[model samples]
Structure formats: structure tokens, C-alpha cells
Target: AQSVSQHNHHVILSEAASLELGCNYSYGGTVNLFWYVQYPGQHLQLLLKYFSGDPLVKGIKGFEAEFIKSKFSFNLRKPSVQWSDTAEYFCAARSTGFQKLVFGTGTRLLVSP
Candidate 1:
């Protein structure tokens, strides 16, 4: 069975700091990658995705991720984060021809203002 893992369960940081969340998946074949973010009281939004083409993909809200096949990792990174960036981050994956998504537990980011 395939599963996703998020290394950080919760993270706290002051405003204007860098942020990085680790995501890993257990799958042998091709997969679709995604990073969805949920704001304080909002629904999930597609922060970024890696379907094909480049291994490095950039998404909205100044967030980006690198897809490393060898490591089975897709880590999200932001050089400078703001207080408004406080949200819960989830890493998800689906098989090449599958529509169902397997989501990581999630990483809650608390950015202090």
C-alpha cells in the first residue's frame, strides 16, 4: 500500500522567517504530487503540483517544491514567509491512473506576527 508522510506535525516561527516542510511517499511507480494548504479557517487550496515535465515546480503564494525521485520526496520551501502564511500544509499523491489521493497527516504552521 502507498502512504504519505509529513515529517513535521507542527511548526512555530516568527514573521519573516524561512519555512520548509518535508514530504515523502511510498510508491514504486509513477505518481502525481501535490501540496495543498488550508488557511486558519479556510478550505484546501492547491499550493503547487508536480505532474510532469520539470522536477522543480512553483505554486501560488511564493511557495515551491522539488521532486526528487531517488528519495521519493517532494519538500516544500519558502525563502521568506509572512504571518499570513500561517496554515496547515498537506502533501498528497495519486497513482498515474488513479483519481483518489493519499494525503499526509499534515503540518500545521504557526507564523507569529
Candidate 2:
């Protein structure tokens, strides 16, 4: 079984501020990691993912994450955030050959303009 942990429960920033949220997963074997964002009144959307190949994964809305296998971390980052980027971000992990996804508690981001 795989589990995820998000250290940042909440974050506040002004527009154009750089953002970084910590995410760690527990799983020794091959696993897939993902970052999902849920905006106000919107469903969860995929922000980025790291399955294989390069560890740095680029995603929509100027988001990116790097998978560090040794540290079991997949932290998300953005060069500059916008007010529209405010959302609840979740980190998830799924071991290979598994059918279920383990998710973190989620981090709430509030960007002020």
C-alpha cells in the first residue's frame, strides 16, 4: 500500500509570488505520483504527474514537480502564482499493479491579488 503526505496544510501568497508545496509518499516499489488541484466550485484536475523517465514533470498552469526517489518526495512548484491559482492541492500515489490511489490531506492555497 502507498500513502502520501502533504506538509503544507495551508498557504497564502500575493500575486506573482513563487510557490512551493511539499509532498512525500511512502512506497518502496515502483509507484506513480500525481498532483491534483481543485479550484473553487470545480472538480479535481490533474496538475502534474511523475510515472517514469525524467523526474521533473511539467504541467498545466505553469506548474512543475520533481520526483526525488531517495527522499520519497514529489514537491510542486510554480515560478509565479496568480490569484486565479488559488485552490486545494492534493498529492496522490499509486503503486504499480495497484488499483487504488492513496492521497494526502490536501493543501489549501489562497493567492491574493
Candidate 3:
């Protein structure tokens, strides 16, 4: 069975602070990685993804992540975050050509101005 686990359930941050959230999965085989963000009152949108190739990938809103195959981790990082970045972040993964996705419970990021 495959599953995702987020280290934090909620986080509070001040504007312009750096942010990093942990994500790990329990899968031994190949898989596609993704980070989806849902802004306040908005639908989920793709922040970034890792299908094949490089381990490091960048996404919209100055976000990036590195996929560590050995650790079974894909952690999200932002050098500096703004209040607008406040939202719920979900780490998801699925096997190649798999239709369904397994998502983490989610980490709520609250950035204060």
C-alpha cells in the first residue's frame, strides 16, 4: 500500500519568512510526485510535479522541491514567503498512469502581514 504523510498539520509564519514542509511516502516502486496548493476559498491547483528526470523541480509562486528517492521524500521549500502564500499544501503521489491520487492530510500555512 502507498500513503503520504505530512510532518506538520498547521504552521504560522510572518511575511517574508522562509518556509519548508516535510513530505514522505511509503512506496517502493516508481511513482509520480506532486504538490498541490489550495488558497483560501479556492480550488486546488498544481504547485509542482516530478514525473521523470531531474530530482529538483520548480513551480509557480517561487516554490520548489527536491525529490529524494532513497528517503522517499519530496519536501516543499520557499526562500521567502508572503501573506498571499498562505494556504493549505498537500503532497500527493501516484503510480505511473494511475488515475487516482493519494494525498497527504494537508499542512495549513498562515502567513501574517
Report backbone clashes per prediction: 0, 0, 0
Instruction: Give candidates' CA RMSD values in order.
Output: 0.7, 0.8, 0.7
Q: Where does candidate 1 stray beyond 4 Å?
A: none
lDDT by residue (6-95, candidate 3, tens digit) is 999999999999999999998767899999999999999999999999999999989999999989999999999999999999999998
lDDT of 1 at 113: 92
> Whole-model Cα lDDT per candidate?
0.96, 0.95, 0.96
- Per-residue lDDT value at 90 in model 3: 100
Candidate 2 stretches greater than 4 Å from native:
none
lDDT of 2 by residue, 1-113 (tens): 56799999999999999999999999979999999999999999999988899999999999999999999999999999999999999999999778799999999999999
RMSD of 1: 0.7
